[model samples]
Target: MEIISKLSILIVILFISCHSGRGNVDVQQSADSIAVCHIGAIPSRFTALHKDTLSYEKGEDNVRMVFIRGGKFKMGSTDFVDAQPVHAVEVNSFYMDEHEVTNAQFEAFVKATDYVTVAERPLDPKEFPGVDPAMLVPGSAVFTNPSKVDGMDNFLQWWQYVPGANWRYPEGPNSSIRGKEDHPVTQLAYEDAEAYAKWAGKRLPTEAEWEYAAKAGNHTSETYYWGSEKKENGKWLANIFQGDFPMKNTKEDGFETTSPVKSFPANAYGLYDMEGNVWEWCSDFYRPDYYMQSPKSNPKGPSSSHDPQEPGLVKRVQRGGSFLCNDEYCERYKAGSRGKGEVNSPTNNVGFRCVKDI
Candidate 1:
């Protein structure tokens, strides 16, 4: 996977996946990072927290759930270095959102509770001690799809930090979610997802539970959540990259970006877009070697996050691949693979669904 080497200067964002050989480059040498956003930084979006206890029924009214009769399944995969040492793990049955949290859902939560997303909040001077205040404007990572690239190592070729890019404006100041109400909400940090989950009386699913529900009944097998083939009877199963990576998108899957929820068929467990569309944030703190020492049943990842690539920044596990996953560059679209991102660095390709305990 293409990893974001550093966010110290321009991007101020999180990294992407830990997929394959990037052939290592000096983190400091290449510093002409993504350009800053055009607009001025947003004013105080902070709102007072509500003290009244929220009633579960108030939020549960809109949630459509699928009962995951979770059982023992191989928690990790040998395909990638991170999801390695494939081992047996178990999880109790629980309820999960039928689809990813939609823009409509998040918009409702924001309006009802006056919640402001992390991407909307201005950056702190303490985070970047010497960095220019102008570049510290609030924004999130957005894929630009560069014209031509040398190799896959430098992910900066595609991802850019766009100011004024929040859930309301997915791409930049000009973008909007007018008619895409049912599409999965993107440009959200882990806490943004967590906040929506909390308001909905739900929690982000553990990586184990996510994989279990994603695998459906195909546990212990190396098959996709839908099936072994990428297509069935010449029809694409999920929304993923179709053509050239970072340059040309064939859009063979009928969507160049996020497709509306249920645009594709549901998995056997009645889950929609479990593999692609947008990467879903899990409740687990990411550790590449977590599975090596994970317990047999109900493993909840490492206690604290640690990415050898960027040790100082804390990251969380992001499951499922996005529309950008292609064979040439990012093939993490395969089953049993993993992706991660910094806790506060929201990106356009990552969003989340929620789960509730039985």
Candidate 2:
């Protein structure tokens, strides 16, 4: 496989958290202050939903959503080549999930549809013509830490393709999500996320929509969802790596892997895990230079995917950072940073939430 292809596979596996500091407050206390609106119980019109608080929920699983009253904002950043050429863009108002889709919520969808995720299917030999059929077993990528590594370039050093690894078995066949139903669902490919969205009567957010909501109507150029600072008054606002990447995790955020949804305080618009939890799949195709040709109002992403590093493979945009993100290496936890993965590749670290048109 090409380097980019390898990187995409590794991205899925590396998906992998924090704590009290100055101005420390209990998480439960913070949640109690925010009002949660339930879907179906609230007005069906977008304007009505927008008038209420920015958060909503529905179904037995309580799929929470937050309304984003969108407008013009600068998209992209100059810090990275792909995020370069920052430009102004506008998006209409919409409702977004308050947190990443939880395992319980996805389970409800699967039970209703009897759906099987892409990760559960065996690989097709035609896709890898020269590969031995023996290696084509069904599986998804899972993260494993080596004692040490030379550098981040060799992703295979930390990522392993384990048979029987899927959403329910995030680590592999031996692992299970028995008590982690509230945690974000993982090992999901792009199609898997889209399938759940369709079943829930929602859709994945566009890159522009995701970015706009992440900004939370701030409109000002900022590095994080909360503000320019990564932490607030010494408190770790989001779940992200606190120690060495792919080796040691300090667990300062009270979680070493995926935490339950709403473990941290929500953003200004009441969206949780917008910075770090799992990288979310966007509706648009990936393109490094899409910002240059992006529209001023409600820009969807590029018409088709294109990654110069691996042009042959189709990819989609993955926003937000994940639990594995760290400042030393994968600084993607930053709000404006961007990531991409192959459409069919699934990993323990990759998951998604949904959005409604209203």
Residue-level lDDT of model 2, residues 109-212, one tens digit each, is 77766677777764555654565666556676676767998865565666666778889999997999989989999988787787777667788999889988
Top of the candidates by lDDT: 1
Which ranges in model 2 have alpha carbons more than 4 Å from their true place?
Answer: 1-62, 128-132
- The candidate 2 region of ten consecutive residues with least summed lDDT is 35-44
Quote each prediction's TM-score: 0.86, 0.81
Query: Model 1, range 1-358, lDDT digits (tens) per residue?
Result: 0222334233434343344322223322212122111111112212222233243233542868999986888776665667767888889999999999999988888777777777877767565567556666777778787899987556667777677889999988899999999999998877778878887888999999998898888864565666678888888999998887778989999999899999998988899998889989999998777877998988888999886656766678888888887655666666787777767767777899999999
Who wins the TM-score comparison? Answer: 1
Estimate the lDDT of model 2: 0.70
Model 1 worst lDDT run, 10 consecutive residues:
32-41
- Model 1 earns a TM-score of 0.86
